[model samples]
Target: MKRINRLYIKSIFSALVISLLSCSDDFLTKEPKGVVVADLLNTPKGVDNLLIGAYSLLDGAGSSNGFPSYAYPASIRNWVWDCASDDAYKGTTLGDFATGGEVERYEALPTNQLIEQKWYVMYDGVSRANDVLKALAKAKVNMSEANVNVLSAQARFLRGFFHFRLQQMHFQIPYITEDVADPALVKNDHPVWDEVETDLQFAIDNLPESFPGEPGRATKWAAMAAKAHVHLFQKEFPAAKILLDAIIASGKFALVDNFRDNYTASTENNKESVFEIQSAVNDGTSQGFNGNPDSWTTNPYNRFLPTCCGMYQPSQDLVNAFKVDKDGLPLLGIGGPKYNDTNLKNDMGINSADNFVPDTHLLDPRLDWTVGRRGIPYLDWGINTGNEWVRDQVNGGPYIPIKQMFTKAAQKDASHTTFARATAINYRLYRYAHILLWRAECAIEENDLPKAMQLINQVRKRASDDFVMGKVNTYAFPSSVTIDVDYTKPAANYLLGEYKTFPSQAYAREALQMELRLETAMEGNRFFDLVRWEKDAEVLTKFVENDSKFRVFMKGAQYKKGVNDHWPIPQSQIDIQKGVLIQDPAF
Candidate 1:
């Protein structure tokens, strides 16, 4: 059956007619002047209005609301880190989550509220798209035919986007198509994976190529990127590799030398970013409340912003993850007094008991680009959180050494008057570095070690002490494995006064995941990465149990059975479908 897509729109009211109409009996032959619902939507301009409504889908005012809808939920539902509350399901056990102050219980399929919101937002977008599709079938809009194609493509992207979200959250969902289709047929409880794949593939086929002006909407590359990701999750490895390879070979997307540029508002579409929700600075037309000082807690300034939310603190485990040099030497182990922690304290004008101190020999080029140590001055090109310290973890009030503060105050530049407010650092969604890593992942799975190593080196080469990139020339450190010092004792260790190997990929992957955790930290992709790699639950548990502050913080958390595995779908949905919709086994 051709996939069913439909939407319902209605107006309700009570009305009465005036007796003055009696005089109109003489004019009975004249055509009626009252507005008719169907007729109001049949004109050329009517189609234009409908198309405008379709475009609104991208802004997220409609059902498929951006960020908090799919992206936030996906990130929040998996294991990342605890911020304000220990009740985070993705961050803690469901049992412990219930005992905590946080609201959502993502583990229980029938009980969790996230699933309800997820299902609703998706269908809302689907219904709107359906309405536009139905209206276009009957009305020939006055605009050029090319515009019609673009409009149609946008609508399809929205529909496909919503469906894809449903597929991600719930493995099986009813596929909705055009407005004229039967509702019962469209609401089938167990739609096959192939059906959903086809919809995404269709969207990939119909979307426009990436152009100068199209920021928020899905482009051909975005669709293809989504497809590659979906196929990877589906375990269609070779197919995904082929598509990703094509995009990588296109040379259209290159790695930005300074990692910070990827997140700034003005520097968007900078070689990276396969697909992202386009955000702007103070443009009244955008959906995100971008400059809202109240919600700026997670803003780039939060790390540096003195007034914002400094809750998403990076763990020492994460801090020690960066490679000292690209040759793979670790920055933390065996190197005594990595950097004069005192220098970092002076630079940021703050003190950090647990701040990362890099080894002198292996201070990788990206080290300065990654974490904000104690004494380092806030550079315009890197993360601006003032100093290495994070304050209290429980309440947002006090500053404790164990829980050092990562606020915006660290990024303040005396030269720029507005440094206290906005920092233009861009959020990296998909960097060439990640693409290289992803390609390496596929190669590893395929047992193509040589190919994997080559791709890995391509990323490593950028961080080489050779400094061929010129832009980051000064920060690049040597990548040679010269020292293999053992760091077994605390007194002799660099961190604990111990000395060890100067540089290795053992630390590379650790640093990579750690940076990915901190860099993308609260952006909502952390938990997903862990689960996809089958390590979220295990790794998080290990970190929490071993770390004193984390243990104390997670003390009352409830770790229920299977809470670590998958989230439970909300029960309300299954009620609508009777027995057709089975709740996930544990739920």
Candidate 2:
């Protein structure tokens, strides 16, 4: 809840730009002397300037203003709900929305718009890194070999990072490392996954072990973490484990003790984060504009504005994933009877509770960390949610009347209620807990139940007040309880659900999945996690049926459609590419 915008202090682009421009008067001069081509372009300072220019892409109107970035596709598109629904991401059109829906053939026109944006942004990054790499090859700047290697490594890491995002989305994209021979030609070479792997491998091997005392700059650990993720995507489990373990053992990072710390603006640059997009709110008119997606999605006023886009919202599917307790327990069977608290309100406003279910707090720590309910004490909560009241949107649902969730304090200033205030929580891109889950996934794949259990318990150990731990006594259903829609099934029989203990492993897996569902939910991990685990079919089926916890809490009015799964690439891209680019199959 603390405002830590002050912690964002590193800005290498500015320094590089200044350094490059100061090299020679010819650098900024319009005409070359005596018609001779300027030598400044090839100079060390000029090369540095080029690198700065590459980084400048990150600050372009599309990205810096929070308009178009891979972050949108990567973090928001597929994750608004467990599986997309017309009510959510319109993912039902993707055929994976878990409900039976018509397949939406990719309309080249709309899909291309987003594709082009992501494509160009990533390539822009690659082009810049390539410039740095090329400069290092030829520049005669008098610097320590160590410094040169460090800088070069950072560049390669960035290049690899951009490529990784591109490859994941488009599956195939041109891997242009240098300025192409013809600037007019947008390179059309789409490399296979192997080639993408090769590029990332180079980054892993050559990157420096750490940044030069700066957090955002690429480091050896960042490269390794990226490599681990890439390897996982390729199903190279051993190599993935090796890379992940290397990063973990380096002792450079760990999970923050307070779960909420990872999301608070004040803790933006905390040690637990392995890597994160460095966002800083410019001073002056933009008092708190740090370029975070949270400012857009989670802020009260931003979402209400017609012009401001509503990228994502916590789906009832995800909101239901948290276990009532933390001791690695399941909630479905042991989760007990769902309870509704009419008085409950989100940090958003008074009627916010209309879309929320109170028993969600049965999950204890995870819920407290994920969403802000009525009573939690946050000084900033006072600033944002206090005494604010606003009309709630009709959420396009029939089961519940949409309610506005906020306090009188939040609604006072229309500007403060909007994203203009920077009240949204910053997402943690990488955390130590994910490492534990990663290891567990590997163990599960290997069928090493004991190892998987060990890692899971480690996470549980840290989450002291979670459901399985029995710390949350408020909603603890009696051991003899069972819930069945049939009404004929005895509550005791349902509670036992063929398990003797309250939160059994059968229930625990459900619990862990729910924990993951809630823990990483809107942050962008859900869709990918489902696909990677190949659990989409079954999980989404439940999602569409409105049987998932999120829907259950809302009394099951949401209809899941399959098309909601995959997003249609923006249409504008196809129009620009004409016949050059192809659209994704089934959109």
Candidate 3:
């Protein structure tokens, strides 16, 4: 199967209609003068159109819908919630997205507007999935059984995916379906994990291993990955292990040669992707949201996007996470979450004019790729002007994000949209590396320490040897975002190490945890991973206490797990349900 060539205009045009279709809408009911609407839609084309509409919302790029433009906070990147992770800050200013600041500080409340918007976007996705199923049911077209099976499977897979996203945020949520007559009366009294698993299993059992020409469509492997994730989230170790074993054994996917490939537009939807959210730019005449507009605010100011928004700043403590020992293994054990080494400081306290020597620690090569720090080469954007790119020093910190960015060479793929900063760089919802690490997690859970160690090393070896982002010399305009640059002079004193052994299950677990953080850090999985491991309260509370000196917004922030562990059911949703929706008791 072809991994990626480039997303053509046809695929993009059909996949971005979710922004136009309202959540309350079924199939478009109205017809022009003589055409019967249902007759046109009761064919294979109609079913496919609804399916495409379902695919469109995967980006959650949001809609205008008669209001002044607003990118609802449901980006598939999960950056809004991802910022709450210890590794990132809501970086621009405390006043901007103050609710996001509350989320970061662990003072999250049910009334938070962003939380409400996230609820709306996720439900909108679920409704879109239902739209596909509803259309398929009334189809008068003479279609093969295989076609029916694939169509239903893809829709349920998406339904499971969207509901799973919501359940991860609010533990108690209603599992809405096309069968439900009155959604507002639906209750959130029980867990939706079982329903989510069933939907995914149906998809897994029915979907083909690959869709051949359509790389964006969900496949059996995608369903399997989603099912395994659902199992892992519920701590169903044996169940998750079975699915993961199948996926790894299939030999359908593997890590790409370069880490930059995972983020760059030109290399998107590559072999690394198990499931990737596809985004694309139009030639200025598309009717719906073209690419990922919701992700625009995360871009840096002055240096890149015209907007002053630079939220999702890398934390100083996160930079410390990249430090490796003489053997190249992460020194995460040196200190707890916040291992403050003055040597790793990227001009934090010093004046720009002062003659300062760079603190070159033996670091993980992934650091510069994941974060854009002072003097560090930021893609082809030349050496990053770190402090100058920062919107707020005291709260946002010195580091800028780099992983969400596309290389300068692919700007047309990333930038040519109505939202000038809108990017076509696909978000890898699940990649081959994710399954490899999860397999290691399963190994650790099974107490097969050596197997866990081996799997962890498998992932580590890739980071140690991949062709990393090298430097170019132009300062005015980014000369190169290419990894093929002069590696004779590297971007940092980078050294990566592999684990020799795992002495105990605890040690194996810690190693896996640290590796997961280092591997997927800014991609937005840290905070939730901690929650999944039942370590949020313990880990995040400690992170705040230690890193508060570096980030003033966290100075006295207290983290109590109730509301912090899971977001409460949105107040507006509960009101609409007319007291039927039971809020998360965790709150």
Q: How many backbone clashes does every candidate have?
A: 58, 63, 3
Q: For residues 515-562, what per-residue lDDT tens digits would candidate 2 score against the true structure?
A: 455456445566556655556555555555553333222233332333
| Global lDDT of each candidate | 0.43, 0.44, 0.73
Judged by lDDT against the true structure, how good is candidate 2? 0.44
* Model with the higher lDDT, candidate 1 or 2: 2
Alpha-carbon error at 205 in model 3, in Å?
Answer: 0.9
Residue 355 deviation, candidate 1, in Å?
A: 12
For all predicted structures, in order, the TM-scores are 0.64, 0.67, 0.89
The local lDDT score (0 to 100) that residue 220 gets in candidate 2 is 62
Error of 2 at 527 (Å): 1.2
* Model 3 lDDT per residue over 1-587, tens place: 11221222244533343333445422111122323554555578877776766676677643324221234357777777877778888888767878888888877777887788777777777877886776678783578888999999999999999899988888788888977776667788888999999999999989998877778899999999999999988999899999999999998898888876788778877888999877666544353145655446787765554433687888877888888788888765533333444437566754433434456678888888888876666777655645566777777888888877766766655765455566666788899989989999999998999898888888888878653445433222223333234546776677887899787788789889988988898887887898999998887887888887666788889888756878887777766666788877766
Cα RMSD (Å) between model 3 and the true structure? 4.6
**TM-score between model 3 and native:** 0.89
Off by over 4 Å in 2: 1-116, 140-145, 179-191, 282-290, 302-311, 325-328, 332-361, 373-393, 396-420, 423-427, 466-515, 547-580
Top of the candidates by TM-score:
3
